[model samples]
Target: MTSIDPQAKFRTGAVDMTHGGGGRAMAVLIEDLFHRHLKNTILDQGHDAAVLEMPPGRLVMSTDAHVISPLFFPGGDIGSLSVHGTLNDLAMAGARPVSLTASFILEEGFPLADLERIVISMARAAREAGVPVVSGDTKVVEKGKGDGVFITTTGVGVLPEGVSISPAAAKPGQAVLLSGTIGDHGVAILSKRENLTFETEIQSDSAALHGLVGSMVDAVPGISVLRDPTRGGLATALNEIAHASKVGVMLDEGEIPVRPDVEGVCELLGLDPLYVANEGKLICICEASDADRLLEIMKAHPLGQNAAKIGEIVEDTDCMVVMKTGFGGSRVVDWLSGEQLPRIC
Candidate 1:
């Protein structure tokens, strides 16, 4: 790779086929934009792959792809969303994330300014999460063949000894907890796509949750299961845990917090808050004895201030998730039948 002029016309230029042809243009893009923002010791090594030193513990890895439409939203863009999404997956497994690798598929004719913005956002998110992007690859597709850009991020983490969390770990007499309010991210994306406005702006809750997870693990290492309800939201997540553990879940609708504005938007759109996506919230299942402590730990964290003990696990061969409606009726919260909001983190 060769250095390019500092004033490389990014402000008004667009990506073209030459940028991915493995030549001068490609080198300039890598050196001037990607490397400039995402530089770190390991990444600056300029190797084909990252040489990583693993911590003395179980290895955990997770990968996520971001193809969110509109690319940017009120609270987050595809860049930070990719980082948070992958790191959150590792956190769910009780792992401390070490590093991340990001790959971008850029559409021909995409604006360089926007691409630069995305890279900068990704770098900031990774730095704030105490993780570095150590390796990456980029390619350009034909203009008519792709969206503006798609980001795929993979994260690696280490799980400490005596910590084991899995979907199948939930058992009877366990408590189910939520990290915070739901439907924020999904509604934010929908509002942006549809050009809808509300009295108060709704922002996506796109944040990395590993710090919160670390505190929880330090306090309660015996946590049974942890899951981030992303695409299918809380209802689908609970259904998955129920089937995996062969247990039943009973939830209090009032206990699950949803923002008033989000609820109003859902009602107006004829959508269920339970089926909407969330980027920052998580579902925690643990022994009833540890519930209070876990909730305390979660609530103290910045990301989980709205944490709530929503439900409990029960012995049931059928593996169902039932919720006690605030209206004094109970209903089964089944898996989401279809995509509530597509390309939503």
Candidate 2:
């Protein structure tokens, strides 16, 4: 028998089918490995699932999976990505994320050391977001039957009374606000994967933005909608909101913030920065008067330091997102038929 170090073999023990079977191996792994990293009262209940107590408010829920290739990237890794993705989903719904459930699929022949690093990163992310992984499950597949590891996370939050937000609520004349710079996450991944050199280093904007979301909501109670521009980036997010609310958008090309390095990368690769992925950015649509307050609150936070009002909603017969170029021309921004950057989130 291979000696089990017994100290939560996060860095050594390879997961086997026995870890998934409801036997001593499962219990031991859960106790010494999973619970060891994700510590919380509800998790201590020791049941198959976590029983949570909800606050006095409406419930908001969301789920997401993390499968970013290379696992580790410039500023973050897959583990933290899992937590951030689900939390962002709940946050965009104007909810206070209370807890999360994690499910892991591990592949045979993968080193346990990498697993621990990922789990630790996730724990750190959840802690920073002030949420917990209250319950979770793990499974192992035969070699080549799975990627090294894939994590699916579900988050539940509570929305305060009178806090109604949705894409359908967006109105013409409402203002559009962006949380921060764009395309950092996509450029960071591409640089690492392709070994491209850049004058200034690019880092992934992978982070949990629930705190920023809370502040924005508090600043403006009547904020119409909030959407994080991720996989399809700002263009797709805005187009969706336009279609949802039956409004047209005229974006100020000069107003949108794009890092110079990201711009250079796009110029070199013929990619549009507006369509790149972002992990820590959000797009807020709100009444005209509330735009300044919302932007003020977003700018006050570290995650939204570069916040700006990029455009405004307009009344039009056709729901379209048209951008006013810097040089004086208009172009329609449409949804991407297929992903421009695959496996990004």
Candidate 3:
């Protein structure tokens, strides 16, 4: 093996076997690429794992693997999605995320330019969320054996005192609140698919929801449940809560927010927006009495400007989720039968 220039532009090169061989090439890649973008004191220590000084409160952790196709999408990419997904998981637990660890699996021959772009995006997202990527690892696989790149992120957070939020906490007489519109993220990814094009461009609502969650928790500490409707969309997310709490969810189709363009795209594709994925949105279940106050608090936040009270919990032996149609009809909103859109975060 030959020595490589540490100052060389990695963005112009392609990831090769040497980059993942745990030698000088790998060190140069880590220092010049990952370190340069995701620089932080903890990460600068250059250890296999970060030793974080625990903050005052209960600690919570969450991990997510992101392999969203079309690495680059309208509002975000795999890198940002990885950060948001993991952080949101912590936020749903009513914890404030503090640090993150991102691991990247790169395919040989993958363009370094794209990898650099993703890293930069991850850096920005983490910075904006006040969460730093304090540690990470990178590996390379044979070209044909891997996607361009797959990123997994782990997040750690501290839960506030007296705050206990859980899916099983949902109960009858609780109002269901959604942070914002649904299906934007799914629609955005679908529009970018190889042969699919839509009349209007839809941007993925991929964003970090910790701030929004913090605001809601601060206002209403007793909020029963907080969950991000990610992979299986709002329908699947609520269904999970219903089964966990042993309650039924009744939603008003008209009250649920869905962007016009997203609804149109769903109609064209023979899909239900309710079953599509969402990156930034969350489902909040709180006492029906707190519904109005919580809705006001959520709407004041930028992320929840379109927040609405979509439904409520009911006592049901079967723990089913039913939605009242706009035409005054009721229907069952069951678990997602099959994969609606695969590889979507």
User: Per-residue lDDT for 85-172 in model 3, tens only?
Assistant: 9999999999999999999999999988889999999999999998999999999999899999999999999999989999999999
TM-score of 2: 0.96
Q: In candidate 1, what are the lDDT values of residues 1-345, reduced to their tens digit?
A: 345454467888899998889898887889889999999999999897999898899999999989999799999999999999999999999999999999999999999999999999999999999999999999999989999999999999999999999999999999999999999999999999999998889999999999999999999999999999999899999999999999999999999999999999999899999999999999999999999999999999999999999999999899999999989999999999966888887
**TM-score of each predicted structure versus truth:** 0.98, 0.96, 0.97
Ordered from best to worst TM-score, the candidate numbers read 1, 3, 2
Predicted structure with the largest TM-score when compared to the true one: 1
Candidate 2 structure quality by residue, lDDT tens digits, 84-174? 9999999998999999999999887677778878888999999988999999988888888988899999999999877899988888899
Shift in Å, residue 336, candidate 1: 0.6
lDDT of each: 0.94, 0.88, 0.93
**How much lDDT does candidate 1 score?**
0.94
Evaluate residue 136 in candidate 2 and report its C-alpha lDDT on the 0 to 100 scale: 93
Model 1, position 55: C-alpha lDDT score: 86
Q: Clashes in model 1: which pairs?
A: none
